[model samples]
Target: MSNIGICEYVIGVIHDKDIWYYVGRYDANGMKLKPNEQYSSFLVDAKRYNDEDILREELESLPKTLTYKILELQRCPKCTKEFTEHPALSREDNETEICPECGVKEAIQAYINS
Candidate 1:
């Protein structure tokens, strides 16, 4: 079975010299069997700041120039893992409660069964 997926994006912006620049983004994808529920993935842009400390340092360096906010957070039903995006989950209706890794296993099992 094919599963459709949905995603939500949280954009991070920094105001420098009155110009707002997009520094990064967080993408959250819906989970299988729970289309409405979304989770955050570790995947992020902002190559200059890969770690939270670095990101914070850069933000703090600019003081009033930097600001950020999280739109939401979601948890994986199968693994209980929290993420900004669950790209591996399925948003299709009547889907099973399986994460991306487990979903791959399920596909293999189906292939073998067939």
Candidate 2:
């Protein structure tokens, strides 16, 4: 049997310490959250994708602005902190991806050991 599903767009705002706050979602008519509906205390708790390609394609189609960079929020597996910066490869494994801060720390540790 096949499963049915619905897809929607979401918006988030960066908050303290790079934490992302889920602001709202878009419906068939348009984006659902209005000015008064905005909030910043909540974290995004839902997985919003099944197909990565489709997700990227849809997000890329949205209009860009001079004020903001369009990107996906990601969590660094090493520190469990959220980040929007490009990840650096873990020196310990050279395979695991980590946040930029952790990468710098790793480099420093390596230098100390040498």
Candidate 3:
């Protein structure tokens, strides 16, 4: 897996809360989760590692099938919130992408500071 690049999206199930979520654009190291983060079950599809939009679209349509119990998971790394709109790159780093809301907030802050 190290040979492959980092995965931008991953499917994880929190058994205790019965919640399923997808972490987006998280490159703490690789496709693997942080040490503190725990999930009853999780999936890392090497094929979908870099396919952010495609993976989300496929996961969205998965509920229609019988394979997935539920598909309510999406979190922005910066805000840790579910973002409906397209992601925005953080101005702070330019490389770190975040949710639209956070992006707006950052822009506003930058404008105010300037």
Note the Cα lDDT for every prediction shown.
Answer: 0.40, 0.55, 0.52
For model 1, give the 10-residue run with minimal summed lDDT.
Answer: 33-42
Cα lDDT, model 2, residue 47: 26
Q: Distance from true position, residue 107, model 3, in Å?
A: 0.4
TM-score of each: 0.28, 0.47, 0.37
Q: On a 0 to 100 scale, what is the lDDT of residue 38 in model 1? A: 21
Best by TM-score: 2
Question: Which has the better TM-score: candidate 2, or candidate 3?
Answer: 2
lDDT of 1 by residue, 58-101 (tens): 44544353455332223455565433434354433446444666
TM accuracy, model 3 = 0.37
Q: Go through the candidates in order and give the clash count of each.
A: 10, 0, 0
Count: clashes, candidate 3: 0
After superposition, candidate 3 runs with Cα above 4 Å error: 1-74
lDDT winner among the candidates?
Answer: 2
Compared with the true structure, the alpha-carbon lDDT of candidate 3 equals 0.52
User: Residue 112 deviation, candidate 1, in Å?
Assistant: 2.4
Pairs in steric clash, model 1: 28-84, 28-85, 39-83, 39-84, 39-85, 40-83, 40-84, 40-85, 41-84, 41-85
CA deviation > 4 Å runs, candidate 2: 1-66
